[model samples]
Target: MRRIGLQLASVLVLLALWAFVAAMRWVDPLYLPGPGAVWDAFVRANSCYPITEGAARKICGESNYYLWEHLVVSLQRIGVGVGLGALAGVVVGYLMGSSRLLMLLVNPYLNFLRALPPLGYIGLLVVWVGIGESSKYWLLFLAAFPPVVIATIQGVASVREDQLLAASSLGAGLRERVMTVILPSSLPYVVQGIRLATGFAWTTVVAAELNNGIPGIGGLAFQSGVQLQTALTIACILVIGLVAVALDQVIVWIGRALVPWQGKEV
Candidate 1:
């Protein structure tokens, strides 16, 4: 109860500060809009509005590339990209960790790729794959893949030799040892990697949507900025942040369920 109260109070303080700054015109309204302006923009985004440019004209709300559509598109891209990347990273990381020759062969390429900024390859991806869903997926995959791979490798390398010895002394076969010991021991690191990858995936969404003009939160935000709709842009940014937090919490919940023993200090 106390913690919740404190959180609420903190939010209230921030809101108060924002209202003050906006009311005082500390920043130009074109660049910074008040909470009320943001709320109006949100309402407008959700409500039916007329388009004057069409022959017959039509009322459009969120149905025509609105908030929900943007959210869904972004979520789908992130989900598919992150899921595949994490899976592939785990496999490659395990192979590299288990075999010195494999590590030697793959290390240089992995280092080079990981060192590059994820968005730096957007132009290359657009050229190779076109400005389609495939490009966005590849961008997000690159954003997520490296962290997961590095984390998995670190996890595998951190496994204590005594644990392996114990498994061997118990007459465990290679498969059994790997399944029961190696995988479980590495799960905490895997979860951490996934959490990190999720954030990276979200961060990459804006860059992925740059030229593709895909219906996503990032694209909406970009459009809002281009139109100088500061309130709408801020609203879109807030939505993105809230969604990221919610997704991260889901990942945390899954991690807790899968590795209940994690952080127990046993």
Candidate 2:
């Protein structure tokens, strides 16, 4: 409760500072819209719609903004891309961790790819796959895959040799050792990697949406920036942050449920 109070207090302080700055016009409203303006923009984006005529009249309420649609698309892309990337990363990482030769073979390529700026992959993906959903998914996957791989490798490598030896003495085969000892021991690190990958996936949404001019929160932010809709842009940014934080919290909860022994001092 005390920690929660402190967190709320900090947020309140920031909001107060922001309100003061906006009220005093210390910065141009064009660059930083006040909270009220952002709220108005949010309401408009969600509620405002256009009336239509003729046969399309019943369902023809078209608004310049479709916040929900954009949010759904972004979530779908992130979910699928991150899911695939994390699975592949865990598999490859387990293999690399288990085999020094495999690690040696793949490490150089992994390092090379990881060193590149994530957005740099966007152009290459566009050229290879064209501007389509495939390109977006590829970009997101690339954005998320490396960290998970690294984390999984580290996790697996950190497993105690004594545990493995004990399992072996207990008549455990390779598969049993992996299933009971290796996987459970490495799960914490795998979950950490997934958490990091999820952040990457969410951050990559803008670049992914830019590929085909797809309608997502990223597209909305890009359009708002292009049109100089400062309040709307800020609203979109706030929405993105909120969603990312919410998703991350969900991941954290899952981690706690799966690895209840994590963080306990030995």
The candidate that wins on TM-score is 1
For model 2, residues 1-266, the per-residue Cα lDDT tens digits are: 99999999999999889988999999999998788898888877777433553443332111243687788888998988999999999999999999999999999999998788768778888899999888888888887889999999999998999999999999999999999889988999999999999998898898888755447899888878889999988988999999999999999999999999888632
- Please report how far candidate 1 places residue 74 from its true position, in Å: 0.2
Q: Write the per-residue lDDT of candidate 1 for residues 117-208, one digit (tens) a residue.
A: 87789999999999989999999998889889988998899788898999999999999889988898888998999999999889889998
Task: Tell me the lDDT of model 2 at 67.
Answer: 82
Query: All candidates' TM-scores?
Result: 0.94, 0.92
Q: On a 0 to 100 scale, what is the lDDT of residue 5 in model 1? A: 100
After superposing candidate 1, which stretches have Cα over 4 Å from the reference? Answer: 52-57
| Residue 157 Cα positional deviation in candidate 1, in Å, after optimal superposition | 1.2
Q: How many clashes would you count in candidate 2?
A: 0
User: What local distance difference test score does each model get?
Assistant: 0.88, 0.86
Clashes of each: 0, 0
